[model samples]
Target: MFGGRALATLTRYRGGLGAAALAVAVVLLGLIEPTEYFALDQFFELRGARSPVAPIVIVSVDESSFVELNTQWPFPRAMHARLIDLIAAGRPRAIGIDLILDLPSARGERDDAALGEAVARAGNVVLAAAPADEQAGYTSLPFSYSRTTPNLPIDAVRKGAAGVGAINTPLDSDGRLRRMPRRQWTGVEWLPGFDVELHRVVTAAGLPAAPLPAVDPILINFSGPLRTFPWVSYFQVMNGTVEPTFFADKIVLVGPTSDQMHDVFATPFTRGRDQMPGVEIHANALQTYITGQPIREAPVWVSTVVAVAAALLAAALVVRLHPLRALAAVSLLWVIVTLFAYLVFVSGHAWMRGMAGTLGLVLGYGVTVVDHFVREQRERRRLAQFFSPEVLNEVVRHRREQSLSSSRRMVTVLFADIRGFTALSEKLAPEEVAEMLREYLTETTDVIFKHGGTVDKYIGDCVMALYNAPLQDPDHVLHAMQTALELQERTLKVSARWEQRLGTAIRSGIGINTGEAVVGTMGSRQRLEYTAIGDTINLGSRLEALTKEYGVAIVISEFTRRRLNADFLTRELGEVTVRGRTQPVKIYGVLPADLRKHPRAVIDVSATLTLSGAGESHPVATRDVSEGGMALAGVPEAWAVGTRVEVRCEGGQLPGPLAADAIVAWRRGDEAGITFVALDPESGPIVADYLSRRRSR
Candidate 1:
């Protein structure tokens, strides 16, 4: 049960948190972060230097060119001359310009005259070819399509040199230039980009070449994710500063590299490099192609599954575990994966994943934790509603106490009954009886207020009331006695009206006793009840039943009567033997409080004839009494003392059976008889006390 409850609680907790967490994870993983993650992936593809193998190197017009020339966008044609002279002096292979000479500019006539003459003179030069992009009247054809503006200058470049290389680098969604364009179209011809053009140039110049390895294209023998190669400034190369022989028989590709150009791309070689140019990317691409081993290209579905599954798995695991454990586990997994991913990039020439996996685990754990706590609080509230009003109060008290590491004490109990209730019920209609009973009990119950009594319950016409509380009452007996007397007076008023209406009279009797009993909640966890209970409670019940034997309307046990401190008119009802008690107890009746002041103390007894009339002497032990009945163990089976009989005593002749049995109460289940002879001495005082107490109330 414990394991099941714990598991269920954990499940519910995670279930709720998972829902909200799922939403956040979806937003971040699917919508917001993918673009960035994919972008990183793209940049890595290009800079990874592991694909589209081809031998090539950059001849860049980077920050150095701009800074030395004191100009930004437009470079004088004479600059092209100096670059060409340097390459031509080396007697090198192909030289592909990575920039555009698209239209004539301010110094165009002078610069173009010098550069064009020099370009025509140099046998190894490939002037840069600029296609009219969509922004400049070139239609957005697929990269393979040859659509362009009328002034693309492709024919002019084709006529001026060994070849016009298309220098466009194709990028993936991640903005990384991974794959080199296989081909680019001009108005009249198909062409290779700088990487391919340079490849042809190098080979024609008698360089070594080999078949490239490929996943898509081929991998290049070049630095991986973090490796770096050397670089020198363009202006320095042109000022007769570089050893031109290094350029000999070497293929060079060149273009701009400045942050202002906004040509910067995400690549593995340099982190979103500001001054790297398009020609450098092309050079990287060629190296990748020539090396022949491309990074393994995984299918798209693999990525999606890995991302979502990682999220779900981590979430499920943490749903039942403690939060700290879940978090530590997630963190450890993240670190392990990150290390492995870096190794793939460094050693395997592959980029796996970065932040996506980490985010998935964290989101899973967080969502489940939030859900668990909310469910716990709600369950406690739901349980509180399932108990009865009385029991609920006590259970709640105990529960609150338990939370604070405490508990409640046991309570005392008392029970009372009306004498001759069966005969009373026999004379009335059910409806009339019910109405009268309700009114009578209501009045009696109200007296419990002065007595500090809590009415425990009602059984037929009987009342079970308790003192010493809902809390302890210091003078509980006084309260019980006072309350009982008030009830008697109130019953008289209620009975008078009903008697007139029903043409019948009513009388009630009460018995009360008190003792400590177990008092607290007891029941199922789902539903608990609070009540006092013990042998003390059972004793109170047994005492109420014995009231009829003594022929007294109110009888209290020795335990109860002893708590009283005040003196009052009273009568000693003969010893009454009750069921469940092996011994008999002396019971007492509270005399009416004002018995001395008025006609009071009413004692009413009724006896049914159980056995009588035969001519036999009753047992001797049965004949000894103070003019009162003794419940005899040795009575004749059928005895009739003919209205009176004498007892044979040891010392002298004793009282007759009729006289000795004067106070024998009504026979109610093996009961002794009350004879008329014993009533003379006590009748006046009892009646006076009953009336007096009734009046006081």
Candidate 2:
């Protein structure tokens, strides 16, 4: 019961305009770095990052070496031998020359010839062979002062040892290098980076390409720099003045290293302002191959789908839930993901888009939540805490719980209208009309509630209602009748006053029927309303509509008239055909007769009071009565067919119910029959007994 009402309340609130606006808000927000969703793509392009599954070294031509060797632009070939000797001294695997010899130098052919003679003597020397800008153009294998040099062609070098493809790296859109390139375009097929290429070179030399224990300068950590790496003068090396171990068996990259004059690259290890030579960049690349710390990028389609789905999820939540709840739920989602990601990021070396995802979630939720909540707040700007709250607070309580369902319990419904409101409104000013209708509705609606009825909705001058909801009223039928009669009486009093004030009477007719009705919120996703539909409800409306025909103020169906135990004067108006109803329904009309005047006399076998005679408060008790399956002794003889009643004891505060007419359908002896009646369902047995005892006293 509790769950159903809560659900119904939430459904009602959901059908309002706020939900639609919230849905739009959610769609427009929901991602942080939707653009950089494919991070792995960027990770794959870094050349230096992908190199070095094996050890590598670089022989750089530094500025100092340039000045000292006058080898300024083109250092001679002998200089490479000296440095190669020093590296070879380490007994390393292989050597690679990142230095491009595509262009001839100013040193002349003499220098190149001598360099070739020396290179022929050397067993392990590698030089760079790169593609020319023009396919038809070819200068030399290794430029050394001429169009050609002492270096062998790439094909020859591949024969002499394992020559590797050393291709240039391209930058990403942002100009920030963050990824590693695995392979580059070869003349025919894609080929590996410098590091992988070096692995082939080393293993070809009968040495394994497996990772080795080498003294790394930056692997574990980096704080500051040493005076410098082993950098000998280029000319000094050419002149054979440097150590021979440098070229012994090391994997060396011979590349330019001048601060203002060499092909250099950015690296994670670059200090202050000094750039690492391209040779060292290759070295880093090789080391990266050894570690294999690859960052995976999501597929483009996956990112697009994820982003779009995230938006849809937000929309779903918005339309399905209240703005406040959806906001909290979204916040919880981010927190959970962030916590999960934090754990993963710390434990796993996986760097899968942290900041971007965060930005997406934060921005998405922030903008969406703010938009949703703010709009809701604006719509509820006149938000009041139970302003003129109804008597049956079940709706309010259900609203608090935020459920979305409807129950199939029975409820009594009532429909009421002013007997002549249409003509009255037509005669008055709009403002005056509004004021009059508002005043009457306010009072009449309150009366329905006072009897524990839910005012379903007000249609012009008519009010449709239900009973036994929110807080279940056991005597819903009884209350409906009471509410109807009460409203009729209040209207008479009010009408008389209005007549004196405005020289016109405002008569209202109330119609109430007690039966099961389907009451709930019903509508579209864009809009909805709280009301009911059923034949019983139709009958109730029909009864109210019949008031004009009957020339009586209050009308009710047999279903309702049979449940009251009060002294209300009602006449069975017989059958009446109502619109949309196939058969005529039995109905009744309530006359504004004073219960205190006749005191509901049950004419005994003793005396009879004239219809116009004075009366008293005492209910003439019948010794016996019978109605349907019910019979009672010492039952109030005043009991009429629809009289409201209570079970009473001598001096026990009437323990059961208020005075009912006992609904004497038939009378026999001292035993009179009384139909079971509930005057007020919300009103406990105490109020019933109190009324019965007081009336008897």
Candidate 3:
């Protein structure tokens, strides 16, 4: 029961639950390292390649250069010095040597002196440095090392370069290079990257402050796969084959391009065997700084907010749309989020988290759609349990669009209680009592249902039913009366069987009232009940308790009595003050089922008669009267059998004048009979008084 109720509550407040689930998912994503790189990589691929910048260019030591120089793997520093001198003549903005010159040249001091002289003449050069040891932890903290691996430069070459920066390119968990940290900690101080140091050399006056390592890494928006920048062969520069103007005022990077050099790394734009050289990667970074657009990534808080907002949008759509439409809407929302991420990255150089946002959208909307279906099914089940099948059908058919909120509706309520069941239980076994009560309650409920009433609930041996709720009925009071009458008969029949079986008697008293009352399915999201409550329902229960005092099987309040037609015969039981009430309520005892006509009557005299067709009035002597009809002696022949007339009885044997609108029933010579079409409430006391006196005499 608890589980079902909780499920129902979740189903009702699905929007909140969905939002909470989405928030949890976002937190988990943020806390856990990314296991999948497909979403972010796809975004990179979607943005595709961009045009290379003009200021940054690469001077490649390609296979051609190796063959022309006729030098082994690490070419002697003489060739590099000669090539650098040839390029320095153009007065380039800056020069970045992608190779590390930590060791002396094999050709001895002459080669070292030659390279140092060329570098010193260049005046603007940045040397490459790498961490001495591998970083191994979540934060990738570096080891204690005072100098860069391969050291920055030998004393001969170190004096020429403007500054030295690390060349450590960290790969993500997916083994793909997407971002590069701008600075690193070396236990003693923070070291900037080769590209950042080059940027300082190239644009000394316009440089932004160096960013810390913990700051969000720069998204490497690669311009192309490989060799995107203008490349000149080292041999070509040394041989004076390339024009000097090619390197003038340009930030030139000299690096190996031959496949055997092993200086290539995979980038976002990498495809198949086409990877970017480490020199070009640095060049791309330098260009990004020079252009003042680094392709920033969304901060942790922004990603979190985007995820939750996506979830909320999806949830709101699911709540308002059909399941199919919701599916379509969520799919569309995912697309929109994906497109938005791409657009932001393209226009603002900021990348949003696409994977978390899309996941939140799909899951949030899907869960709520399922919840709505479950809630509707539970609502139908609850309605079916309280109402008769006929009433249930009416509710399903007519009230499908109605909201199940509590509201005031004029409904007729009936309360029935077994009179002797409490005492009889003491004389019978527990099993016998249970069986007897079940049978009695079942019969009572069936009778109520047959008269088109809703069974609100069974309180021990008492059964409460309602009319004109869950479904409206024009003749609700009549239906309640009929149910009570039938229930009385049903109880008597059951009591006779019980007397034969257990030597015990069972009787029931029922009360009915008709008036305005609050009625609807009411409860929390977890549980619901269709019932009625108000003065009408309270009076009905009160009258049912009064049945034992009045010694009657069925008692109905005057509110119900006044709404009834002339088909019923009742005894005015006077007024009694009930509990929780300020005024005395007039009540009536429903006469037993007689099947005979005019079962209620009064002995009276002095009645005024008016014929339907004739205008003449005559005084008549009254013999007996019933709510249905009255008999009179010395009636004129003008009062025909089929004629309708108005009758008024003066206060001769009654407290007040009695007036009835009636039709003629039969005529025996000068006497005519009339049947009552309706009776005014003022005459009820007069009829009761006359009947009370007749019984006395």
Look at candidate 3 and tell me the lDDT of residue 343: 87
Predicted candidate 3 versus true structure: per-residue lDDT over 1-697, tens digit per residue: 3455545445555763666466656556654226225666666678777787647778998999878878777888887887788788887888889897878887898989988888888878888776575434444456543333345578888777788887778887666776777876655677788888887787673434343324445766667667777888888888888977888878889988877888788777777898788888887777676666776766666666665766666766776678789789888777777788788877877667666677567667766667667866887889888999898887545432323467898888999988867788888999999999999999998998999999999999999999998788998898998898778667767876887798676778888888899887777645788888788888888899987776667788888899988888687878999898999989997764432243455456678888755767788877777655677877887655435578998865677888986655445566655666567888866676666666631
lDDT values for all models:
0.56, 0.53, 0.75
Each candidate structure's TM-score, on Cα atoms with residue i matched to residue i, is: 0.41, 0.40, 0.50
Separately for all candidates shown, the number of backbone clashes (residues 3 or more apart, or on different chains) is: 41, 74, 0
Q: Which stretches of candidate 3 lie over 4 Å from their true place?
A: 1-10, 13-40, 134-150, 205-216, 387-697
Candidate 2 C-alpha lDDT tens digits along 455-541: 888899899888887568898887777787677557656655665667556767777877776666666645677777788877778
Residue pairs whose backbone atoms clash in candidate 3: none
Among all windows of 10 consecutive residues in model 2, the one with the lowest summed lDDT is: 216-225
Which tens-of-lDDT digit does each residue in 185-272 have in candidate 1? 6656666555665666666777776454434333233344432433456776777677678777666665666666665565544454
List the candidate numbers ranked by lDDT, top first.
Answer: 3, 1, 2
Clashes of 2: 74
- Index of the highest-lDDT prediction: 3
Minimal lDDT window, size 10, model 1: 654-663
